[model samples]
Structure formats: C-alpha cells, structure tokens
Target: MSFSRIAFTVTAFFLTTSALTHAEEGKFTASPGLQLYSLRSQFKLKGVSRTLDTVKSFGIQLVELAGTHEMPIPEFKKELESRGLKAVSAHYPYKRWQTEPDAVAQEAKELGLEYAGCAWADHKSPMDEAQAREIAATFNQAGAALAKVGIKFFYHLHGFEYQPWKKGETLADLIIQETNPEQVKFQMDTLWVVFPGQDPVKLLEKYPNRWDLMHLKDLKQGVATGSLSGQTDVNNDVTLGTGQMNWAAILATAQKVGVKYYFIEDESSSSESQIPKSVKFLQSIRW
Candidate 1:
C-alpha cells in the first residue's frame, strides 16, 4: 500500500477504537439521578447542607426528593440550586394526592419538580381489585390536577400491588388498566418489582408508555420472591451490580420502553458507601 494510504488507515483505526471505548465507558445512557430518601439518615445526622454536600461528592447532579428536610419549600429549592443539584421528581403521601392534589401540585411547583408521585398506596394487606380501582381513581384525579400545573403525576410501585386479581392478571395490572394513560404514569422501582416475583423487562414492555421514571434499586441475593407484603428489611437493599438483579437486561429493556429518568435508591444503612459503587456499576454496564 502507498505510504499516504497506510497513514490514513491507521488514523481511521485509532479513531474508531477511541469512539468505541468512549461509548463503552458510558454504556448506561439514562444519566442516573439519586433519590434523596436514600440519604434520609444522613440528613438527620449531618443536617441538609452537609448531606447535600455528600450527594454532590457522589457526582450526582440530579435528585429525586422525598421531602425538603423540613426546610421551607422555597428555601429548599434555593439550597438545591446553590449546590448545583436539581430535583427532577418527588414523592408525596397518597392521602395528600387524594385529598389535596392541588396543594401537592403547588408544593411540587414550589420545589421546581417536573414529576411528583406517591411511593406507596395505602391499602389493606394483599391489595384487592376494589382498592386498586380506588387508587387508580385517585391517581387519575391527582394526575389531571398536576398536569394543569405543568407537572406530571406518577406512582412508584411497591411489591404489594402484585396481588392476584383474575386469570393471569394482578392488582397492578388492574390499576394500570383503570388509570388514565396520559394523566397518570408510573415509576418502576426495580427492587419492588423483583421482590414481588415479577420481571421488570416484561412489565416495562407490557406498559411501555406508562413508565416514565425508574428507581434503580436491587435486592440482595437469596431474598425469597413472590411476596405481596411490600415490606422488607431495608438491609436487603444492595449495590446495583452486586445484587441478584440482571441489570444489563433490566436497563436495556428500560431504555427500549422509553423510561425518561433513572434514580439509584439504596435504602440500606450502608447507602453512603454503596451508592458510589452503584454509580460505577451503571457507568460500566454494557448490554
């Protein structure tokens, strides 16, 4: 080959290799955020300012708020802004969404959140179809109210919603069917899904558009599944890749289903130590 041609070929090879490496380095494309509730104890022990500093240190610029750590809404928003952190989503109580959705919308607006949701639906053990329908009605109403204020309303699934409803359907399915797709959306908490003996990928595929957000949590190995209790030891929460979850498949499916936001939520007592490892795992994962 001519010398000029040889030089060009070598340059092209190196450039292609570099591009591939760069892509692999960031295989998880969801730009994972943090759920501030993962640091709840820290906020209590170290206070909000110091706890926020810890969040910043983890290289997370986006967060999902549980509350303002008792700070006034405006003041909390300012604190987040000053530290270069943004609250993209938050979780409010189910009763608040049912009784005062407008108030919830106002608080979400004040906090500058784009999405607001309830993490757990208040229901009797082994949730039934009637309760599911009621919850769906509440979600639809709250969602519409929030939408009027330009904020999306969502529900974060806990394991309990998986109670059997009919032939090959669960209460979760009933709730999804009953809720308004455009008004009410869902957040798939990975651990909760897995703990209930459900597959995240299947659920995501089944209701693609309804899931706009995700909680990237993992259950510890050997934790029995098929439970509808929605109650588990917080310590069962584990770092992303170190747990029983098939992250490659779960995340790949989540991406395919158009989940817009992902948050790492470690409820274990060791969250401060586990979170960085989870972040690294997500960065390094390749599907």
Candidate 2:
C-alpha cells in the first residue's frame, strides 16, 4: 500500500471504533445534577451568585453543596431556592457534627437537604490507625443523630479510604460494614475510586442500595497513580465522555441498584466549559 492509503486505512479503523462507542452511549440516561465543587475557581473569579447563575444556566435543578462560604444556612438555602435550585446534599465536617450533632442536623433540615455527608475525614490533624478508628466512631454516632431529624448521612470517599485496614480489609470496607446502612450511606466518587486502584463497578455491586448519591467525576490517564496521596493536579480531571472510565457499565450499575442521584463533579479549572460538554454527552446517552 502507498503511504496515503495506509494512513487512510488506520484512520478509518479508529473512526469505526468511535462510532461503536457512541452507539453504546445511547444505552444510558443523563442526570440533571451539579457538583458544587466544580465552580470553586469560577466562584472565586466572579462571585457566588455569578457562579451559581452559570450552574443554573446549565439546567441543573439540584446541587450537592460543598461548603457554604461561611454564609448562613438559611441565607444560602434562600439564594439557591430563589434561583429554582434544590439543595439535595451538603458536605458536613465530622468534627463539627461531633461537637454539635443537633445543630448540624437542624441546619441541614433547615436547608431542606435530604442528605448530609463528609467529603473526607479529618486527615489534616495527623493521626494513627487507632485515632482514625475513634474518628469513625464519632462519624457513625453523628450520623445516627442526623437521621433523627429526617436527614440521611453519607461518607464521601476521596481515595484515601482504600488504604488497607484491619484483617486485610480496606478502610472503605470497614466503613461500609461499621456504619448502619439505614442512617449512614456512601457517595462514591468514581475518579477517587479509580485513583485508589479499586474498581468502582465492583464496589457499587458489593454495597448495592448502600449508595444513595454519587460524584460522577472522570480522571485522565498519566495524572497520578497508585493512590490519592500522590500529588495530582485538578487540571488532570476531565469531562465525562473524554476520560478513561467505563462510563456505560458504571451508569448501568448505578441504575441497576437504584441510585437516587448522580452529581457531575468537574474539578478541572475549565469547569464552565467542560461541564456543558459533559452535559451534552449525557443528553445523547441512555440506559
């Protein structure tokens, strides 16, 4: 074959493969939720309202709140509701909940949030295994308290919990077994699940209805490896259809197990641009 013919044949092969992938995407349905963390940079650039307006423009009806920028809970809720958005979930630190479980639960209830959770444990304080175990105990107790107020609690994994703990069990496994599924559920962030060298599909299957919420974040290859402790840049996080995840099977399993929410969490600095692309991809898919 001539050089041009060889190049044309190679290109055609990839084009066909792309077509098949796009066809498979038709099996899944897109979700209409936002991960508030995606606007971190933009919020700092313009302001909270501007960032939120952008999110609302994306047709997002629900959001998973990261933190409220020190804004009062009622005021934050008001702002969100005024723009026709519902506060589905919020990330509450374990320490604050332990200090005043009632206050946390009351604040969450006031915000009209169905779920309150921790994005991560207090790993900043420098602790050992025993200390970590104690912290888990406090989280479970606080979770139980939150449940009394008609709020469900969740533990959001950030790849750290994949570390091996007692009896060859990962910290994630321990958390799942220890926490009461009725009061405390989990929110698996697929990027972090893959970051920890774990298969998210397997984890989702193992736990079943234990996960009521999820962060649908994708990761690019060559960003980091082995664990979250490795310094990986947020720019390395990419949009859904543009990453290295098996999204079809992932979404299929979530649907199978009846996940209540799938919040798109774009941590990349270019979230405003990338989020729309991800939304467009989701809109084209079905399952």
* Residue 107's lDDT in candidate 2: 83
Q: What is the TM-score of each candidate against the true structure?
A: 0.92, 0.85
Pull out the clashing pairs in model 1.
none
Best by TM-score: 1
Write one digit per residue (lDDT tens) for candidate 1, span 209-265.
Answer: 999999999999899998889989999999998888999888888888889999999
99 Cα displacement, candidate 2 (Å): 1.8
Where in model 2 is the C-alpha error above 4 Å? 1-26, 124-132, 166-168, 228-231
Candidate 2 versus the native: TM-score? 0.85
Model 1 scores a C-alpha lDDT of: 0.92
What pairs collide in candidate 2? 27-286, 27-287, 28-286, 28-287, 29-287
Q: List where candidate 1 sits over 4 angstroms from the true fold.
A: 1-26
What tens-digit string does per-residue lDDT give for candidate 2 at 1-287? 99999999999999999998877654555456998988987777787788789989998888999888667877787889889998899998777867888888888888888999888687742334665576578778878888898889888878776677778667678778877778888898888888768888998899997988888888896655576462368887898878777887888898788788889998887888899888887776664
Q: Against the true structure, candidate 2 has what lDDT?
A: 0.81
Worst 10 residues of 1 by lDDT: 22-31
| Cα lDDT computed for each candidate against the true fold | 0.92, 0.81
